[model samples]
Target chain A: MQIYLPIADVSVNWLLLLAMGGGVGFISGLFGVGGGFVMTPLLIFIGIPTAIAVATQAAQIAASSMTGSIGYWRRRAVDMRLGLVLAGGGLIGTVLGVWFFNVMRRLGQLDVIIAIAYVVLFGIIGGLMLFESLRAMWLKRKGIRRPARRSGEHPWYLGLPLKMRFHQSKLYGSVIPLALLALLIAFVGAVLGIGGGFIAVPALIYLFRIPAAVVVGTSLFQILLTMVAATIMHATSNHSVDLVLALLLIVGGVMGAQFGAIAGRNLRGDAFRLLLALLILAVGIRFAGDIVLKPEETFSLVTLDN
Target chain B: MKRSALALLICLASMATATAETLVTSLSTYRVAINSNYTGASLILFGSIERDARTAPRAGPYDLVVTVRGPRRTALVREKEPLGPLWITRGQRRFVDQPVYLAVVSSRAIDDIAAAPMRERLKLGLEAEFASPLPGPNLMGEDFVEAFIRLRRQQGLFQEDPEGVVFLTQNLFRAKIDLPAIAPTGLYEVETILLSDGVPLSRQSTNFEVEKTGFEQATVVLARDHGFIYGLIAAASALVLGWLATVVFRRE
Candidate 1:
């Protein structure tokens, strides 16, 4: 069945949209990451205008992450103080990002910018994930054991002013790095139409040395806020958020995430990471090919609302 | 000289009577409601020609051309240049206030209907419709206009059918106009023109509205009129859906 999207001004297949949401939701639940990195590109591939796809996906991300964050909250795994500090920075970054988004759109270069951003961001993240997971598996098979990490050791940067203790993560770190990291993620998320949870989870793990459980919850929390900001910005400024499209996606996504959570219980961590890495790399390669390959039509047209 | 002038006057009088005609046209529907199930719509523009019949029965055949034009909007056309490894947008041309959707139906090929200037004046074909250029970026010649037309056609926003208009009888005729699934909702103008001996005898135009109705209309109004509230409702609904799903599935 086909349904007309109000703001996007296009009719799309409802089944295809539902399936895309389900697929992304499954990945989000399986990995404990918001699937904006996957959903945004897929939506564009299916012919949703890039601007509408980005804005509408932001709302979907917020919805998908809400339940996950709540589950973590019940387990007391969320670092609320840390999440709030990061969200503070995120809110500021979102303003700047949306401004830049409008500028590129007006110049008729939004598609190229989105494509390049996807190629670079996903390429690096996927490559690192593959390398790290492979190394971990290799080390596990070997007889030699790696040195245990020292939790108390603080990097010189963590010794900076405005230090705060995240009681749940059991670490004392300066807010400067955490805020800066959040700001960067929010800026990228606004422009690229993603929740940036995938980037945040790794950053918190490797850079801040936050515990795995806390990182997921904290990342989700920050993601929820960042996406809310994005949705509001796109709705008011660009008026590109399509609520009908969002509702259809959320229906499949909500259910799929539940099933994915159950399925994730049976999967191994390193193997799961490897699979996700491949998926990310595949999407990145597809985007890269779009730029390098000759286009079917060298000329493109868009109707501007008078 | 007097005899020649009188002969010319007699010929002109006969031609005027032969060209005297009346056109009657109506759409299948006056209002097109874009409901949820609306993929597209096909409307038949049926019409008839009433000739003076007082003149010597014109030996030539009659022709009909129908054109449907949707709301006009500005469009941007951009051409990409291969810049080393990747293609980059090199230049752009803007068409100001051009019909967003245009469909033309004719009994015969438009070019065969009349001379080039006449066809252009009547806007009988896509090329003729672009006679006036809106002032913007350097006019990149016919290539850009052709590109615009081709892109719109591919998107189902523009269409043409030479044989769409068919004559059921000598004076009665009908044409079919297919609005694609992606057609924009707005007021559309449908025009039918009668041609006799390569000269326009009569013309008629009617207006119809294609507006979203029911759920579709409500959503659009909410988003455009109350965007902030709409955003809040969207976010709140998502939160509720997520919470509900989690609670229901927790038992499993």
Candidate 2:
């Protein structure tokens, strides 16, 4: 079928669209990223409406993450109990987040909100990730012994109520904390149109002290569920999901993810973290730059009223 | 007889003077084709200036404006940037194979030091040059090949550079299109307009048909039958190839 874009006097080519989807999918797979960072902006650059881009990206994330999560699960990397608890909270958070997302949309303040979130969160998260990766590299160069165990007692996280043991992570932690973290992450994910893996992975590693070996798997599991919920919510409430666009990206992403998983196995811990950190930092910087600098032209569909 | 001849000469002179001050030319109408991959497309406008002397044909410093509209009668793109002797690339790429209407308007006030009345009566004719079918760089290799193949199979279809076509020195214009072999047969129209001093003066439109035959019908049927399964297999193969290529190329 011929699809025409009157504004650009251009027609859509299905083959080209599929190729683009595949390319983005490959990147996501290799990098273990949600691909939303690149996909959303690229869509905007290519003249897609922003809301459509975000919704379609969410669906794509759901499909691509399913493969990753399944792969990780097969490898005995997923902690189902932990993933489920976190996902339960994530569902609530995502629901709330959808409302908040719509509220911001209605207020015509999405761009400002997105800009601020990118600058603030990206600065903090990217900086921390960078610093940690760099420090790990420095220690390795100095031939310092790696810290494999904690000498002190379990921290305050262990002291909270409703503590439960995560067999895979081998830690006893309060379920409340896990739930709260999931909710917070999901809320951010919904608002930012991301899968929340970036926040969740870091939170699991630093806050909960989940072993690095299991962190990514556990995070993917949670991301998988959260994205699924987000997709359904957006589809039902906002009627925003563009299945055609989502499918195109997913087809490419699945292939990319397969390759990424293969490559990731070969990288050392420091190298992996450094690469991931740099990627995050790069995305953050680009996003921040767009917001801080005055655009040559600015147009929006939303009017300045809630 | 002498008086009548003088009167006739006087009338012709006045008409020539009026035509010399503002000239409108017809440019070729563009038939847009959209690539199905993109969600939409927009148009971009640009032009340059030229200068000239009296009785020497007008030269340089031409002020040109361009606007595009869709078949549904909505404004697609517009530009008003002014520059002298400029080659402007409107930072807009449309989806492939979709038909869109274009309207280009150009106006320039010639600086004449001659008598004020003479200048007022002096007329200028405006001409437009259409950019021919040139392959856009961004068109992926695969899409280009497909479009090229389709174009080759269509009878009575004039093959222009897959890049684009450029028509120079005519103002109001239109395109008569003949669809390709693989193309779904339909009516396509292109409209063009020329304006002087913000006033609409000349307008033209062209219509074309895409006729389908047995071969085209068979190709469509075959494509429909196995397109999904074929796409899946192709994608899988591409992934494997891409992976292998990356590994080989980046071996360390």
Candidate 3:
């Protein structure tokens, strides 16, 4: 099927749609990330109306994350109290993000803002991933036998109020840091239409210094709530959730995620991180290329609010 | 006593004949079966009608009608093109199966005290096929199958409602067509028509029966007996195969 967008004079192909869904699904399962970074660009490439794509991706994330987080909860790896608090902050942040999106739309500067966000975030994240992966590879070549460990703790997070102990995370941390992290990630999630797992997982592991074993499950728990809220908000507000498409992708993704989790269990910690880093770097480069290069043609569409 | 008995016997025979004359039209069963390779044949209702031609035959300044009635408040009516003396040419056939067009005529003008309202009667000229043209022959069978499903969706008809009345109105008439593939096959009236110019002239009707085919029977049995296992296997195979194909045909 080819759906024509009147303003852009572009047609979207169903085959491309299926491919994009499958590719994003696989990456999401493999990395414990929301894959929104990949999905938004893929949607644009395939000519989905921008706002609709964002909303639909949120719905997909909710389904995929629910499946994943349920499995983690069954394994008793989730910190419910912390996750809920973070989700509370996330909800507020998401509302702000949506408001920002509307403001940008009214200013007729959405495209520029999106372009800049993609470039800056991808550059930083991609560089970090590449550097870390290369360093791990070098360490392996030198026959280092030490286990990888969290290196540093920030004094700023330690000084924050509302200190809480998370038995699953095995750390005593200030709730303020966790809440702020959640808010920041939620804003990014709303803008990118992902569940914010990419940011959440890293923040849990590197900043909060949560044990690597529990980080995935905890982050997924947070993602599940955030995505569900986001999906509901988008659906009722924008009516952009394509239930049919979401069902198709999730039916496939749930089964794929189970297998991916099993595969992840078999990999070494360094090996997993290396693969994730490479994936992030690759995605970043792709985004950068799209921004810098001249597109085949320039097209515009009425903003979703219109 | 003999006169009364003779009249009763005549009424019984006439009633039987009347029941047999009603013409029926419907899309009772539809399916799109594809092979493991995603290539197979599918059937679509191109155009179908059972008309009671005895009462409303192809003659004079009259109209032919077709309708599809289904679940919910669903209704679609179409009318055949009107034939006039000027339209008939030297080699022109009696009827042409061209695109059906919707009737715009008001039913009140046709007959005052006899016929039902326009909504009650089957209007004609609605498009028979709901799907757009396939991009190519490779997509033909599946495309039609999808289109058929979509048509059912538009009418809110599916496994939920298996039967509905499709009425045809012109004058005092009754007919029906038993569509093929109605589960638990039995007798069905499909079509009916009324003939009137100055007075009631004649009426016609048709009948058909629906029965499950071997493929349909087998599918139903499989679904009832082993649906879960079959679905799991299909999902697994598709995932494994899709992954392998992507790996082999990896695009940089």
Best by TM-score: 1
Candidate 3: list runs displaced more than 4 Å.
A1-19, A145-154, A262-268, A303-306, B1-252
What is the fnat of model 1 with respect to the true interface contacts? 0.66
In model 2, state the lDDT of residue A53: 67
Residue A210 lDDT in candidate 1:
89
lDDT of 3 by residue, A79-151 (tens): 7877887888898888777667656655545554565677677677767876877787787789885575645
Off by over 4 Å in 2: A1-20, A298-306, B1-252
Residues B30-78, candidate 2: write the lDDT tens digits.
Answer: 3333333333222222221121243223343222323222232111111
Candidate order (TM-score)? 1, 2, 3
Screening candidate 1 with a backbone cut-off below 3 angstroms (N, C-alpha, C), the clashing residue pairs are: none
RMSD of each: 3.2, 14.0, 16.7
The TM-score between candidate 3 and the true structure equals 0.52
Local accuracy of candidate 1 as per-residue lDDT tens digits, A181-295: 9999999999998898888899988888888878898888888888887888878788788988898888888877877888999999889999989988988899998887889
Backbone clash tally for model 3? 35
What tens-digit string does per-residue lDDT give for candidate 2 at A1-306? 444322122244556656667666666766677777667667666656566566656667666666667667767899889999899999999999889877876554555566567667777887898899899899989999777777566778668899888988877878998999999888878777778787788888877888877888888888878877777676555545554455556666666666665777787878877877787777778777766554453322221111
Q: If you assessed candidate 3 against the hidden native complex, which CAPRI class would it receive?
A: incorrect
